[model samples]
Every structure is written in structure tokens, then in C-alpha cells.
Target: MASNTSLSSLSILIALLFLTNCQAARHLLEETPEVESPPHPTIPTLPKPELPPVPEEPTIPKVELPPLPVEPTVPKVELPPLPEIPKVELPPKPSIPSIPKVELPPVPSIPKVELPPKP
Candidate 1:
């Protein structure tokens, strides 16, 4: 894709041209010795040519534009009042049945057995 190079180069060229002109003007000013305008015999002044008077700035009197007609109040759109939210009656929780305790039978004691003496 071609890049927009004209603006970049133009700006750079403009800067260079500006610097060159400035340098040239500076050198001319610095090198030129100050000399007073040579005095000459007085000459009669020429009549200033009449320029048509700068046309009177047309007095565009601030036309009091009739106040912008008040925007007709848009009647507030009344949405049919949202149907009243229904109160939900939640069913009562069923009572949990009480668990019956079971009594465990007592464990029987085991008889001790004597073993024959090992050789």
C-alpha cells in the first residue's frame, strides 16, 4: 500500500526552505553596514490617491430572530402502568418426621482358651 508521503516531504522541505531563507536573511542583515538614507533636495508631496472608503461595515443589525418557537412538550408517553407485581404465596415447609432411637444389644464376652506349651 502506498503511504501518504507528500505531507511528510512537504513539511520537511518547508522546514528546510524556511531555514535557508532565514539563514540567508540573517547573513544579509549581519553583513550589511548601517547607512543613513542619503539626504536629497526636498520634493513636493504627491496627493494621496483617494481609496473608496472601506465600505461601511454593513450594519447587520442583530435581527432579533423571533425566539425559537418553544418545542411543543412531547406528552410524556404513559406506558400502561405495569400490571401490579403479583404477591407469590410460597407453600409452608412440611415438618420433618422425628427419628426413633434404636437400643443396641450388649456384646457377649469371649472365653479365654489355654494353649499347649510349645517344645
Candidate 2:
């Protein structure tokens, strides 16, 4: 929010500067009618100077590179056979014991709460 305020203030300042510059320019122009009027100072004709031609780019000689050496063939290495892993047998899981059900007594009912009539 603070950034937005600063941005808006900056924009307003720029607009004010632009308006002030325009007003000053208009007043100056109005004050100098004679200078702005007839026979605008003729732009003095300047002689067109001849520019020297650009020099041609030098040609570079092509460099010949030596051929790359051939790679040597690698001999096939025989690896030793891996030993077989022995299988391990696990014991069977034991059965869970059954739990006995118990009978619960019934819950007593709550008595009604009575309120006296308001006067």
C-alpha cells in the first residue's frame, strides 16, 4: 500500500512538471512572436564532405588438422560365477485365544427436573 502511494505521488509530480514545462514553453512562444514569425533564419547550407571508402576485409588461410588416432580394441574379461543363496523356511503363526463375553447391568433412568411458574 505504501509503495502504491509513493508511485501515485511520483506520477503526479511528473504530470505537474510536464504541465509546468508546457505552460512555460507556451508563454515564451507568445512573448516571441517576432522571432517566431517571417523569414525563419535560413539553415546555412553546409558542404557535404566526402567520406573515404571502407577498406576490404583481410582473407584468413584455412588450417588443416591432423587425423584422429584409432582406439585400441579391449580384451573380453571372463567373470567368476556367483555362489547360489540358500532358502530359509519360517515357522507357522499361532492361533489367537477367544475372549469370553460378560453381561452388563441396565443404566438407571434420570429423573425429570421441574421449575416453578414465574410471577
Candidate 3:
């Protein structure tokens, strides 16, 4: 990826150098004398034609609708009462036994070893 980006940048730099060299090498010709142009004839204006007015649209007739009838009321219905459920008592949970703690013996100390002197 890095090599590709660097190659593209190098190509762009060479192209710009080439274009600048080409533009600098070009030579412009000397200026020529200007000639006067002939005068144009004026044209007479003609009157514009008149257009006819657009026709009016016809109106639609109104329609009458019949009134809607009233709805009848419904009588209320009575339902039977539901029976009550009996409650049950649960047994008590058993207690856990306590464990007794034992004393640990002391650890023995490690003896130190003598080292030789460095040369």
C-alpha cells in the first residue's frame, strides 16, 4: 500500500513537470491589424395577433341524504359468585448443625545456608 501511494505521487510530479515545460516552450505570433465591420440594416416591427378567451366550466347540482335511525339499549345480565380456595400451612425448616474449630500446630523455621565469597 505504501509503495503504490509513493509511485502515484511520483507519476503526478513527473506529469506536472512535463506540462509546465510544454507551456514554457510554446511561442505566440505577432499581433495583426484590426478591420472595421459593415453596418447592419434595421427591420420594421409587425403587430402581434389577438387570442380568444377560454370558456367557463358548468357547476354540479347538490344532493339530499336521509336521516339515520336510533339504536336500542341492551338489558344487564347477573353472574354467579366464585367459591373461595382453602389456605394450607407449610412445615418449619430444620436448623443447620454448628461445626467446632480445631487449633493448628506452628510451622517449623527453615535453617540458613552459608555462601562462598565471589572471586
> Candidate 1, residues 18-114: lDDT per residue as tens digits?
9999999999999999999888989999999988878667777786767777778888887787788989999999999999999999999999999
Query: Which one is best on lDDT?
Result: 2
Give the Cα lDDT of each candidate. Answer: 0.90, 0.92, 0.81
Rank by TM-score, highest first.
2, 3, 1
Candidate 2, 1-119: lDDT as tens digits: 47988999999999999999999999999897574556767789999999999999999999999999999999999999999999988898898999998888999999999999999
**Clash count (model 2, backbone only):** 0
Of the two candidates 2 and 3, the one with more favorable TM-score, higher being better, is 2
lDDT against true structure, model 3? 0.81
For each of the candidates, give the backbone clash count.
0, 0, 0
Better of 1 and 3 by TM-score: 3
Worst 10 residues of 1 by lDDT: 55-64
Cα lDDT, model 1, residue 35: 94
